[model samples]
Target: MKLDEYLGVIIFTFEHMKDIPVHQLKDRANPAGFEIKYFSPGSMRKEMELLGDDVDDHYLGAHRDDHYLFFLLEKGNASLMIDFQTLPFGKNSLYYVLPGQVHHSIKNEIVYGWFIAVDTMLISTDYRNVFETQLKLQQPHLLDDKQLQQCKSILSLLLEKYDSDVKSSFYIPVVHSLLQSFIGMVACYYSQVNNTGMQLSRPLQLSQQFKQLLGRHIRTIKSPSAYAGMLNVSESYLNEALKKATGFSVSYWIAQEVVMEAKRLLYYSELNVKQIAHHLGYEDHTYFSRLFKKTANETPLEFRAQNRK
Candidate 1:
């Protein structure tokens, strides 16, 4: 099934649960623009029950979402797997999952949380860079009591506006403003906890821009010098700036991006190894397999067989 259909199944199951009501900014008949969803603990549990024999069993396998997800666990404990990294979270913790990320619940013990799913378009490009690039190296934020309370207050207000009976014209603006504030707060905390201060130097800014561009053109542009040219900077200058800011050369980052995309396509797409290689701009399937093994410590087919659910 297509990714959207899988997401529909998950959403449809949640919509039928006892106390969880999925709120959408747009009407189903004319779905357009970014959509937002809020899920309470009761709804989450009910949806898990709808999916499998037990709540824990239901979410213990890998799955990918087509939208961004922010999960705030107010109480209890759970282990989450995102892109092969196992992240353990407990009360007062927040986890961000980007679109197309391979993730799943590894374990849960009476977990109680709130989940907000936002359409990618709804999130500003600045916030996306913060989330996808800057925050990728960090772990989940375990907020202090004060911070937790502040987040709860924002979430409560957001839900209130979301469920309000006000007219669309009024409600939309209010909720939109609140949503941006909420996301901004999260980004601030993420930056704080990750030790990457909010301010960006010129080199760091260029590094971020380069990463974004590489994400867009990774399959076609495999040369760091080409990326440097595209960014209108000399290759040596680009390398120096990137190394100073990110502790890695541009080539290392490019190779990492390629391997990451290869892993995603291998796990989520039905294309075979050769087809996957060709799709990723490799002419030789054997060379692609060798590169995948060198980067990921496993062959493409082995990785796929082990990861695909």
Candidate 2:
């Protein structure tokens, strides 16, 4: 691992985890040790129970060479950073990391916390919609002890629901709701900081609705113009803002996402090539296959077989 890379696999996050064919998170390298793992509140509690070290929570760890997302639910002073930014974060305040963000520190203190392994798919969605919004809000901030306590309480409750050993359908909705509310809270705060100085009523390009839509339909829709229309923006302006920040044009960005999803479906899912093509909203399956081959350098089936082997 090097710097600013993104790794989302859970077990490989231990820093000491290997890079064999069995555990390859990606072909690329990242910063050596900074990794983030998402865990349910129940999982954190279970970890504490298993470790028998609730009082020994003060310690430092970070992503070795990649961007990570971690929400800590503990107390005491520990520096959480992602690259040039470092801020003391704990149950007292909210801390986040963007892609290529690196952080780690453990002052002599104690509290409880959980590690959550975020899905790359989710992160990709955030990248398209919330990445800049998050980056703009990037700063290690302090919260009043009371505010921090409240944040921790909310996280703890959410984790408790998520980490239960006995899985239930009901838990699914509850966890989803908790995560939505929590991220929304963070985004609201992000807006307060970035939107405060110079407000833009033109609406956030990555509107919450657009985020949800992109997350749901990126596979089917592969044009910035379509997304712009969905958000009631003209294509030219959307492209201008997107390119200004991300360097890629809007259609290109959409294609990138579509290609990624196509790879996943082609390599990970059981769907056949034609089915996968249709799933991605191409009525002309031949065109989809041609595009896939052009971008991937192998036929869909070939790519699947080679990777699976």
Segments of candidate 2 deviating more than 4 angstroms: 1-211
Candidate 1 residue-pair clash tally: 0
Q: What lDDT does model 1 reach?
A: 0.68
- At residue 131, what lDDT does model 2 achieve? 35
- The reply for model 1, stretches above 4 Å from the true place, is 1-66, 166-169, 195-198, 268-270, 305-309
Root-mean-square deviation per candidate: 6.4, 12.5
RMSD of 2: 12.5
Compared with the true structure, what per-residue lDDT tens digits does model 1 show for residues 1-309? 111111233332321332212233233211223333444345445554566653333333445556677878888877766666778887898878776566655566665566666777778876875776561444788889998888888888877777666566677678778878888888888766654444778778778889778867988888889999999999999999899878988888887888887876675456678887888899998998998898889999899788754
In the range 1-309, model 2's lDDT, one tens digit per residue, is: 111112232222222322211222343222222223333224344433453432322112333323335455454445543342345554544556544333344342344454443434434333324434531236654556675566566666766776554356576567656655655555555556555213433444444444445556876677777898987888887777666654656676566556655665554346777887787898888998888777767877887788655
Provide the lDDT at 65 for model 2: 28
TM-score of each: 0.79, 0.43
Error of 2 at 67 (Å): 22
TM-score of 2: 0.43
